[model samples]
Target chain A: MSAPAALQVTRADVCCVAAAEAWRGDGEIFASPMGVIPTIGARLARATFEPDLLLSDGEATFVTGTWAVGTPPVGAAEAGIAYRTVFDIAWAGKRHVMMGPVQIDRYGNANISAIGDFFRPTRQLLGVRGAPGNTVNHPTSYWLPRHTRRSFVAAVDVVCGVGYDRAAAAGPSARRFLELRRVVTNLAVLDFATPDHRMRLASVHPGVTVEEVVENTGFELVVEGEVPETPVPVEEKLRLIRVLDPHGARFREVPA
Target chain B: MQVADKRMTAEQVVAELRSGMTIGIGGWGSRRKPMALVRAILRSDLRDLTVVSYGGPDVGLLCAAGKLKRLVYGFVSLDSIPLEPHFQAARQAGTLEVSEWDEGMLQWGLYAAGLRLPFLPTRAGLGSDVMRVNPDLRTVASPYPDGEEVLAVPALHLDAALVHLNRADAAGNAQFLGPDLYFDDLYCMAAERAYVSCERIVSTEELASAGLPTQRVPRWMVHGVVKAPNGAHFTSCAPDYERDEGFQREYVAAAKDPDLWAAFVADYLGGDEEYYQKAVARRPVEVAE
Candidate 1:
């Protein structure tokens, strides 16, 4: 038998696949290109970054950091309209949010804020800042970047925003919404089983082991009998990003 | 019984308009605003109107369709949908005078105005340029002369409050069933007269049985309540009903192409109010699955 060629893959390569697929190559900034979400903000320009909705499944709380609120980070500056319009260019609504806490429940519910009570209690986190509305409103999705059981639990401590179950329950008006569009990670592609609430196995990222995904999940998800591997970013997505942020604001790991 | 076709007619409602009036609109970032009524106001030749919106297509259409002079908003929002080009062009051309505040601040401002309070103190305008734009809204000099942040957004008083609801009783009691407990209440309370459009008009008894009557608008404050079906189409979906997905997709796609957008407006808005229905009649429903 011919010896298997030496494996060629790294975390960086895997990360890009995780993100690019979530965006489905539609994050067109200028309607230009790259179309990558803000998470992989480094893969884009560094001007003004307004992440869609923080998508962490690991942590349900917020950390006090310069990037959380205050001034814009380094990379987000470029997305602003060239000249003047209304507010500054920092978060002109282009976004790829981060969510902490690794395990996400079947309903796409997350727990990042606190483990117990919110006020003067056990764990305190980024107090529900725009989570409820953000998830319901814009192009919202979640990300573990790194997945784990601690992140995905039976249910979140609190359902800060509408997830798949709630979105469907809300009405047809909100049907095309929070419906957990995508959940990206270091391993695979996850989608819902039906128009209902079951989180189903969509596909695996190239080189990720089925065991890795199983180990990371908190609740029981509908596993696929045969899962295909996710594809990497095509030349079109890369070329598109280059045009949207010619200044290279999003691609680099800079502060914005 | 619920009022069947209980309306003063389009001309009748339009005739009630006066100069230098304030209007309350029901919508959020364009999802549920009354674009048709707004266009009607534009065609009426009304001017110097102070328009209030929680943020919706109403703001842009009013400004772009060439009707508004001044605007009060918390944020004229947009989602996957882009900012209305008419509003963008107007803002660029400096024809529309726009004012903004935080969503909560805007609601409370209207609330205070409704409650007849001069203003309400809030923490929303902090750390944002809204304080600078509407400096008159911010405050200074606490009791101890130490620095304490406070702002008093002006109380909004409107000549008319126009809202679209899911259900209403002919007696003018309207009910809102969305999570957006926005300034609709405050707007209606602050206005001198109120007009409501609803997807369905149910009998007072049915409304009472539904247990939503408590939230209904009393006849005393309501000037007119019209049973306008599909009223929120292309703008916002009726809760629990179908969404205007095709229109939304078409709007975003058209907005991507200005030439296409211009042609779209010419074909649709150029026609009568029913123009939208006929244009969308042949359009296939997206997100149908």
Candidate 2:
């Protein structure tokens, strides 16, 4: 098929492409994206380059083809893998979930559980739902529509998802399957690919400067020689994203 | 010989539960919980109990009522509302002892208990703060040449297990017609005494005809079955009814203030299950924004 005409790419579109890149090499595994933009990205990935990746209907069954975010799956009955089987797949390290963290540190330690002291938290978020298991079991990425100092903290309040330092310290079992893949935020795509596994600014989104990303981050990011702009989705990808998210939910998540 | 009938009322089931007992509640976040049984616990004088769950309103209600002395959970969240208000308040207030595990670790713990094992080795909690906060958790070194060490998630043995399903028989054979069973069977197997509350009590033949045989929780694993239609109210009992999001919003709003909470308790939770159901039916439906 001929590629569709190139259109004006929004930040949300760039974010979707960036998020989908997280699962580019994740062959045959479950692409469990938590929110709208990520969900669109996962669907886009499956529709395009990563066709083998499994996508759950966000409830019980594995689904193919895309539906609008927040709508029910049309034909989930055919691929009915129950919650039990999902757990089994997760434990066996065959899933890559993109979670949203309330706070993330330089080492990639994330917190979704609480804000302050564990004994008496100032604010309690969703208690480490599957962060601990997800991080240690398989490739775990994160998506943040809004990136700020509060989210990019120097040290997280509670380490729900294990980072490089903690994984190294925890020994081989922790390190074996641990893969903190990417942190796709509104501003940039970041990863812990440094020599010491410190979060490095991989690419600044179009119109967003490296200074802006560094300024918003709570801790020092390993900014290398030259940072590239996050790639815009091509005609085909943008068309697929529109098809997957017909209601413009990704735009609602990240805004135009 | 006649088949033994293992039917009981919510109150009767609660009567079987002693104070300070560890109870495992089935269902993930706000879905298909044994909320009728949970409401029964609320009406009773049960206090200082240790509650285990992939919690939702069950944890919130228990926390609001000062029922939990300790809580072992993966997370306490109302799916629509990210954080459960009462659970958050209780945690911030330091009102209850909390043992938070990774969601998978919680499952493994229950699975180990179901298998009557002391602990199950897993890599889930290894590098995360779950180990830091819950210092009592131990690690087991692999006996093989690799000697890989993994967190030994201890068995979450319960005094009782409570689960809500779509249908069941009087002899306590339960079946979930929903797409996901959400570890209900494992919860039942892990507990000493297990009670099931279902939306309908069908005949054995009807129960067998309802869903896949794998979905059925055999009578041997269940100690009692309580038939309470809409038993998992406020939570989604898919193929039955969706989560009462409007009611849940009111519940969350009430949790923010003591006066509102008291009024909510009196208006909704004050009565018996029948009254509660009627109160729910009588309330004006809320239009989603």
Candidate maximizing DockQ: 2
C-alpha lDDT values of all predictions:
0.55, 0.90
**Candidate maximizing lDDT:** 2
Candidate 1 residues lying further than 4 Å off, grouped into runs, are A1-256, B1-6, B140-149, B213-216, B240-242, B253-259, B284-289
Residue B16 lDDT (model 2): 98
lDDT of 1 by residue, A39-62 (tens): 343233222232232221111121
Residue-wise lDDT of candidate 2 within B1-289, one digit each (tens)? 8888999999999999999999999988899999999999999999999988999999999998899999999899898888899999999998889999998888899999999999999888898999989999999999999969999999999999999999888998899888788899999999999999999888988876765663568898999999899889999998999999999989999999999989998998888999899999999977668
Question: Against the hidden true structure, what lDDT does model 1 obtain?
Answer: 0.55
Q: Name the lDDT value of residue A246 in candidate 1.
A: 47
lDDT of 1 by residue, B1-289 (tens): 6444445444466678886788888656655565556656756778878888765667766775667877776545454453454555555555767664555556667778888998876433443334434557645334565444345667888888877776777777777664333445667788887777777778777767756533646666677776666676667644634446567666656654779878767766776557766776766655545
Error (Å) of candidate 2 at residue A246 is 3.1
Q: DockQ for each candidate? A: 0.03, 0.84
Q: What DockQ score does model 1 reach against the true complex?
A: 0.03
